[model samples]
Every structure is written in C-alpha cells, then in structure tokens.
Target: MSDFTTTRRSFAKGIGGTITLAALGSTASAQTAETWTTAETPTGNTLYDVERTANGVYAVGAGGIVLHRTDTGWERVLDGGPTGNGNSLYGADVTDDGERLWFVGASGAIGEMDVVSQSVDDHSAPDDVTNNFNDVAVTGVAGSANAYVAGDSGKVYYSFDDGATGTWDYTTPGSGSAVNAVDFYDARSGHIVDGNKSVFATDDGGTYDKIGLADANANFYAVDSDGADDVWIAGGGGMIHHWDGAQWTPADTGDASLRDIEVAGDDGLAVGGGGVVYGRDSDGWNRQSTPTGQNLKGVVRGGVDVAVGAGGTVIER
Candidate 1:
C-alpha cells in the first residue's frame, strides 16, 4: 500500500441545515443553483440512480416507473407509472457516443431505449448469470461499446460487444460477499468492491488479484478509475480508497457508509445514507449542507454540475 494519509475537515454551507461529511469537493465549482424538488405521482416511491444529459434529468425508481425532467418540469414516462411491478432500478448508463440510453435495475431488467423513436427493448444476458445489478458503467472511451453491471451475490457481468453477450466469468474475491460496484479504465484493468469492505483489482481484465488495504471489513460500495492506475473506491462506514499508480491505500474520509461517489476532473463527491454530501480537493473533505435528510444512494457529475440520490431525493451541486 502507498504510504498516503487521509485528512478530514468539516464545512457549513450556511444554507438550510448542516451535514457532516468527512471530505467534500472544493476544486469543482459549487452550485449556487437550486434543483431540488419532489417527484410527480408521489406514490411515496424511492428514486435510486439519477442521470442528466444535454436534454434533461432522468431518474427511475420502484414500480417499473421512469421520470424525466426538462426546463418545463418533471413528468412520468410511463402511462400511470411505478404502476405495479414493484421493480427497483439500481443504476443507469448513458452511452457516451450519443447513441444509446440504457437502464438497468433489480430482476435483470436491461434495455436500449430509443429517444427519437420512443421505444425501449430488452437487452439480454446469459441465463444463469442474470443479476439484480446495482450499477451500470459505460466504457468512457471514444467509440467504446462495453458496459458493465454489478450487484449482490458476488456478481459481475460485462459485454465488450456492448451488453449483447459475453463469456460468463464469475469470481468471489474475498470472505465478505457481493460486488456492489465496478469500473474499468481500459477494458483490461479495473477494480470492484466486495460488499464495501475489501477490493480486488485485475491488471489483465480477465483475471484478478487482491490488494490488501490498511483497513479490513470496510464494506466499499463503489469504485471509479480515472486511468488504469488512478482509481478511487468508497463504501461502508465512510472508507475511501485511492490507487495512486503505486498501490491501493485508504484515503481518510472517516467511516459512514458512503454508498456512491463521482469524480469530475480533479474534484470528487461522495454521497450516502442521510442526505450526506462529501466534497474533495487537494486539501480533502468538507460537508455540504442542504435541507434534506433522505439517504443519498448515488452521486454523479456532468461538466462542472453534480447530481445526488435519495428516494425521490435529487439535489444539484
């Protein structure tokens, strides 16, 4: 492990309420805009993963429902929406090619939706390998077609041919189970968290090796790689791990179950249960306050903009 140390700091946004985050993003431009609102058809449903594009903001949740937001307002894409099905969406992937819009959720629901055509068709996986995928990651390379989906039960599936089909390769890297999140730098090198505790990395993409960190039993939920060597992972009890080209070491953000995290440019944001938002910079960790108490499931960024997750809980930073 690299001998890097992590430091935690606190901040007060002076807006609505105070949130305690270990480290918060300071290098990125903080949002002075307000983009928080309750979803329509308020059936008391929860929003899982949220994504924004040049068009608008889209969030889907329980009950086979989809919600879209434009400059106008939020609207239900389904006729009656969340209409029954009781299915929960875990994650979404917007193709970087500006070609496809895909969504994945619990119960192996994957689709390629036609934006201009207003149609969505199922994307299939192998029989014995379908999973309640927690997240879908599009290979962030130009003209790349691979998208990987991860979830419970030590499951990890990917498609170099773009979620069409692939060899069923499975592995349990540790004693604690479930691969909650996965990210790839090229197609060959990446890392995944074992129930937010331990991390496993693969230099060859087809095979894997474990990098023992300073903390054990750290339940890490999410992982992201800026390059083959530059990677970050976040998880349970608020443990943050960064691979600084040499080794995987723990970056101190305290412990608090940081469920989801996003890194934009040099800045990053970590969100988790309890309306929590942690911002990171060269100095590391500051809390952003908002008038929310819902548990944030995920955080992502587009441009200098940021979006957070909670049940029907969406905030722009």
Candidate 2:
C-alpha cells in the first residue's frame, strides 16, 4: 500500500472542527480573465463535497454542515443532527429531477432531504457496520428506490426501496480499499474509485468487476460519468483517467492530488490540493487560477462553475 493510504485513512477517521487556510496564492495561468470569484460561507469548517440541486447548489462538510446557495448567497440549512455528533459529511448527490438530496458521511450516517418540503431524514448504519460512508449515488428518476452508498473497507450499501420501506442490502467488492467516491450513469450501471488506486464497475447494482489501470498506484478520489462509455476518474498524485467506452487511459494534469472533478458537455474542471484547478476544453487541459490557497475538495457544473474547499472557501466562475 502507498504511504498516502495510511495517512488518508487516518484523516478520514479523525474528527475536528478546526480548518487552516493554506498560504499558497493563485498561480500564473494561461486563462487570465479572472473567471473565478470567491463567495462568502457561514462557517470555516472544511467542505468535502458539493452538488447541484433543483433550486440551487448545496455543499456538505465538517461538523455536519450543509450550506444551501440562495439568490443572495450561501446559507446554513443544517448543522449537526439530533445526536450532535457533528459527523463530517463526505459526499452528496441530487436525484436527476432535482427533487431529493442524499448525503453520506462519518460513521455510516445517511441523510435524505426533500428539496421542496425542506424536510430531512437521518438514517443510521446497521449494527454490523461502523465505518464511515464516503459517497452516495442516487438514481435518475423521481421516486426512484435505488441508491448506493460506499465508504471505508470497501463497504457498500444499496437501498432498493429508498430506505423508506425495506432495509438496505450491503456488499463489499473485496478490494478492501476505502471507496472514496461513486457515480452512476443510470440506475443499473455505476462506477466506484478507492484509496488503493483502484476502480470497479457494477451493472446489476450488486457485483462489481475490477477495471485494470495503467498505473496501479493511482489513488482515485472521485469518479463521474457523462455516460457509461464516457467516464472520468480523478485522484492523488495529479492523476486523471478517462474511460472511453472500453478501456481506461491516463490524462495528463501534472502531479497534483485532485480531490473532485465536474464535467459538462465538452468542458471539464478539476480541483484539488494546493489550490490546484485545471480546466479542459476542446484545446486541452489548461491550468486555472484559484482565488484561495486552500485544498479544493469538491466542484460542480451549473450556470456557473463553483468549487469549494477547506476553510469555507467557495469559488465561482
């Protein structure tokens, strides 16, 4: 195992409210129009992931913070739950129609929030599971009962009835790798990336097949699919892999640990450690200037591109 595996695993298990903003400033880049702008957040806690909801954008982070973007700015919609553990929320996803939101975080905590009613339901992990849930992926259609949550120790839980009726079915890919992120092209097909620098795909929502990679040590932190044929995976050591329907291939982005990525149409942006931000277009990948030096953890494509990171940093284009 790589040295990062141990350190990242420890970091994931540790819980704290303190967040330090890095001193690194924006680096010189080719795209110099200053497309990115910083927005104010309610807390300095580290934000792990962001997703585009129907009404606007929602960011999840340390201390169970959930910030919703309004027409004016960002607002804290949810703090620590009833237990007050303030378990850090790691990843979140919105249903395709944008009516519901699902989030996963520390100690296998799962939450579902209604976009219209603004009601939230906090669900606890089963007795046999105690590992932190790192990410979640929901189906595309409204009232869809299928959703998948993945996390530490290759643990994965599938809720065929949307956790409203039956209990969630669980499975592990047996890689024993910490599943950092998951994305589904549809209800039946999906992909997962892990801390062991491995990737897997599932078609029946249960069994997964390991996908071979050019670099065996590439620690993937995030995965997204424009379609089953077109998929992108980003990770540590500045690694980005593209799956073109059949196989995975490397895409150059220097040696930076990319924590999250967002792709829209033919354009894509990836942000990560050291305030690193890269944009890809028809021309290719070009480094983009970030306003803050904090490690960017999550990004989403919308009317404007927005990226969030440590120390309550929010950057929009």
Which candidate comes out best when scored by lDDT? 2
Query: What ranges in model 2 sit over 4 Å off?
Result: 1-28, 32-34, 81-83
lDDT of each: 0.57, 0.73
Candidate that would win on TM-score: 2
Cα lDDT for residue 253, candidate 1 = 55
Q: Write the per-residue lDDT of candidate 2 for residues 1-317, one digit (tens) a residue.
A: 00000111100111112222222223347565657888999999999888877767888889888899888899998897313479888888877677777888887778888866667876657544657989988875446647788878787788776765356787787568788888776665777777777677787788777764544456888887676556677887776777655555566577789998876556788899978898877655677877788999999876767899999899998
Q: Tell me the tens digit of each residue's lDDT in model 1 across 1-317.
A: 00001111111111122212233335232453434433343335666666654345566666656666655656667422221344577666565543455666766766555444436655544455556767765543323556666656676666666555444354555563677776655445566667646666665445556664444556677776665445677777766766655555565554457877766446777777777677766667656665578887766665423344555666664
RMSD of candidate 2 to true structure, Å: 9.2
Query: Which residue window of length 10 is worst by lDDT in model 2?
Result: 1-10
Candidate 1 whole-model C-alpha lDDT, 0 to 1: 0.57
* TM-score against native, each model: 0.76, 0.87
